[model samples]
Target: MIIVIDALNRHRFKGLLDEMHRLRARVFCDRLGWDVMVRNGREVDEFDALDPAHVVCLDADGDVVGCMRLLQTTGPHMLADVFHGLLDGEPPLRSSRIWEATRFCVDTKKLNGGKTRNSISYVTSEVMIAAFEYAREAGVLDAVAVIDPVMNRVMCRSANAPYDYLGTPKPMGKVTAMAALMDCSEERIQAIRDFADIRHDVFLTEDEAEALFRSNREAPAQRTAPPAPFPESKTEKADQMPKLPRAPHSNALQQYCYEQVLNAKSQSDVDAAQALIEALSDALGTTSAAELARLARVEAQATRKSVLVAAK
Candidate 1:
C-alpha cells in the first residue's frame, strides 16, 4: 500500500519519515554511490525541509519499502540547483502546474526476486503508479523525474514511459542522469496499474496507519530521543510533571489525561487513565485519542515496572 505524507500530517508519521530517510541513505548513498549528504544514517536535504509531498510504498507489514519525493517546480528543485549542468545552459523548467520528482528508490534487501516489471517482489512500478495518481489528485498536470538509464528502462517496461525528455543525458558518477517529463493523467496511471495488475486502492485506513506509526515509534532501534527522567517518588513526580507544550491540535483534556497516565501510581490510576481516554475519544469524535491512550498506558506500565525493578 501507499501513503501520501505531506506537511499537514508529517508530524503524525515522524517514525515513517525517519525510516524513509534511512532507506534513501541505503539506496542512494550506499548502493548507488550518489554524492549526497548522509547524517546519522539518514539521507536528508534542504528539500525535505521544503515540505514536499512524499509518495511512500509500504509492504504488507506497513513498513516503508519504496518512496519518491515531489517538489513544486516553481521553487528550488534538483534540476534547477543540483543537476543544473544537465540542462545545457538553458533556464530550468518552472511552473505551478509542473512538479519535480526525485530521490526515487526501493529497498532491494526486502525484494524477494529479480528487478523485473512483472516480479511480485519489485515495487518500482507500484511506487510510480502511486506517484502519478497522487500528483493528479493534487492538481499537478506533469512531473519531471531525474532518473538514470537503468530507471529509464524500468519505466519503459512498466508501460509508463516518459512522454518527453529535457536535455541530453549527462554522465553523473557511475551512471548517466537525464530529465524525463511524465504526464500526470488517468491514462498514465491506468497503464502502470494494468501492467502491474493492481486494481484496488493502494492506501491504508487512518487507524491502520496510526497503528503502524505507533509501532515504529516504539521499536527499540528508534530510541533516539532522550529518556523521560524518573522522579524520586510518586508525589515528587506529580509535582514535577512538565506542562504540555502547545501544538496545532492542543487539547487541554487530552493533555491532562496524558499527564495522569504518565504519573499514574497504581492499577486504579491506570484504569482511570484509560477511562478518561475513552471519554475523550468519544467527546472529540476521533479514534486517535484511544490509540494515544493505549500507547500512554503501555509506556506508563513499562516505566512503572522498570522503577519497581530498580527499587529491588
Candidate 2:
C-alpha cells in the first residue's frame, strides 16, 4: 500500500518518517557512498524541513519498503540549490505546476529484487506510481529530479524515461549527476503501470494506511533497504537552505481544519473538510487563520443545513 505523508498528516506517522530516514542512511550513506547528514543512523537534511510530501510503499506486514520525497518547485529544492550547476547557470525551474522528486530509495536487504510481492522492481515502480499520481492529482505537470547515470538508465528500462534534460551531466565526486525532467502525464503513468503489470490503484487512504501500520504493534524494527540505483543529495549543508516562509497554512486554523477532516463522521462534514483543505491548498500552499475560520464558518453552515435535511 502507498501512503502519502505530508506536513498536515505527518504528526500521525512519526515512526514511519523516522524509519524512512534510517532507510536513506543505509542506501545513500552506506551503499551508494553519497555525502549526506546521518545522525543516529538516520539520514536527514534541510529539505526535510520544507513540508515536502513523502510517497511511502509498505508491504503486507506494514513495514516501509520503498520511499521517495516530493517538494514543490516554487520553494527551495535540490536542483535549485545544490545541483544548480547542472542547469548551466540558467535559472532553476520554479513554478507551482512543477515539483522536485528526490530521495528515491528501496530496501534491498529486505526486498529481494524479482517478480514477487516483496520484489524491489515491483516496489520501485509502485513508489513511482504513487509519486506521479500524487503529483498529477495536485495539478503538477512536470517533475524534475537530480539523478545519477545508473538511475537514468533504470528509468529507461522501466519504460519511464525522462522527456528532457536541463543541462549537461557533470561529474560529481563519485558519480555524474544530471537534472532530469519527466512529465506527469497519463501516458507516462500508464506506461509504467503496464511495465509493472499493476492494474489496481496503489494508493491507500490515510485511515487504511494508519490501520495497517498500527496492526503490528509488536512488529520488528523497520526493515531497511537499498534504493536500488537511485540518487540522493550530496554534501548536505543546512546553512545554505533558505528559511521557509511562514505565510499560508501552517497555522492553528489549518490544523483545526485538518483535524475536522480526519474526524468527520458524516458526508456533509466530510464535504466541509474537503472544501477547507482544498481552499487552503489552493491559495499559495496555505492560507491565514482568519481566512480559514471564515471558510469554516461558511462550510459549517452549509453542512448543518444538509445534516438537518437528512434527518427530516
Candidate 3:
C-alpha cells in the first residue's frame, strides 16, 4: 500500500515533521543526486520546515519513494523569488491559479526495480494517489511543475492525469518544462494502470468506477498546448510546444474550472465546459458526471429564468 502524507503545514502536520525529513533525505539526497540541507543524517531546511504545503509519498514497505511539494503563490513562494527570471513575464503564475511542484523526487531504482530493495518507480499508483489526496486536502487547485516531457508522459500514464502545459520546454541543463494541474480521478488512474500493463487483480476496473460515477468513456486527450502563461516577448519561447495539463478534479478543481465555465458566452460553450468538468469530477470522486451535468443544467436554467425576470 502506498501512503501520501501532507507534512508541510506546521499547525496541522507538525507530528510528521521528523519522519518526513528522513524520507526526503533518503530519497532526495541519498538516492537522487540533488543537494539538500542535510544535517546529522537528516534532511532539514528552513524552507522544508517553513513551507506548509509540502507532501510526501511512502511505499508499501513504509519507506518514502516519490515526493512533490507546493509553493503557494498567495504568499511569498519559491518560483517568484528564485526562478521567476527563467520564465517569460511576472512568471505565468499571476492572475492564474498557480503553485510550484518542486522537490519532485522519485526512487528511480524503485520504479525501474534496481539493486535497492526499497524502490518507488515500480509502485507509481500508490505514490500518485497519495500525492493527489494530499494536494486536494491542501487546497491546491493547480500546480506549476518543472517536469521532463518523457517523465511527464510516464507520470500521466502512471496516474492517468490530464495536465495543461504552461510554456515551452525550458532546457535548463535538462529537458524540463513548466506545467500545471495535478488532479486525477480513479477512472483515469485505472487507465494509467492499464497503460502500464499492470495485471494485478487488486486494482479496480476504471470502467466500473466510471459507470458508478456516471462519467463517459475515456476520451482522447486534447493534444494541443494552451496559451502561454505570459505575453510572448521572446520568440523562441513562443514557438515551442508542450502538452496540456491533465483535467483531473476539473469540477472538483472548482477554483479554476468554475470560473472558466461560468465565463463562457454561449450555451454550447457552457455545455462543453460542463461536460469536461463532469468527466473530471467522475474520475476524482464518487460523484457521477451525469449528476454534475444535471446540476449544471439546472443552474443554467435558473440563471436564465432570473435573467428574464430581471428583464421585466
Best by TM-score: 2
Top of the candidates by lDDT? 2
Q: For each candidate, give its TM-score against the true structure.
A: 0.68, 0.71, 0.47
Residue 55, candidate 2: Cα error in Å is 0.3
Sorting all predicted structures by TM-score, with the top scorer first, yields 2, 1, 3
**Model 2 alpha-carbon drift over 4 Å, by segment:** 219-312
Whichever of 1 and 3 has more lDDT, that candidate is: 1
Over 163-212, each residue of candidate 3 has an lDDT whose tens digit, in order, gives 66654556544335455455434455456455544433222223222222
**TM-score of predicted model 3?**
0.47
lDDT tens per residue, model 1, 1-312: 677889998887788899999999999899988889999999999999999999887663446788999999999999999999888999999999899999888888876565443233357778888888888987999999888888888789878889999889999888898999999999998988788777766665544455444544444332454333223235655455443333334333343445567767666677766654553353323644654566566756766786799889
Candidate 2 per-residue lDDT, tens place, 102-192, comes to: 9999999989966666788889899998999999999999999999999999999998999999999999779999999999999999999
- Candidate 3, residue 91: Cα displacement in angstroms equals 3.2
Compared with the true structure, model 2 gives a TM-score of 0.71
TM-score head-to-head 1 vs 2, winner: 2
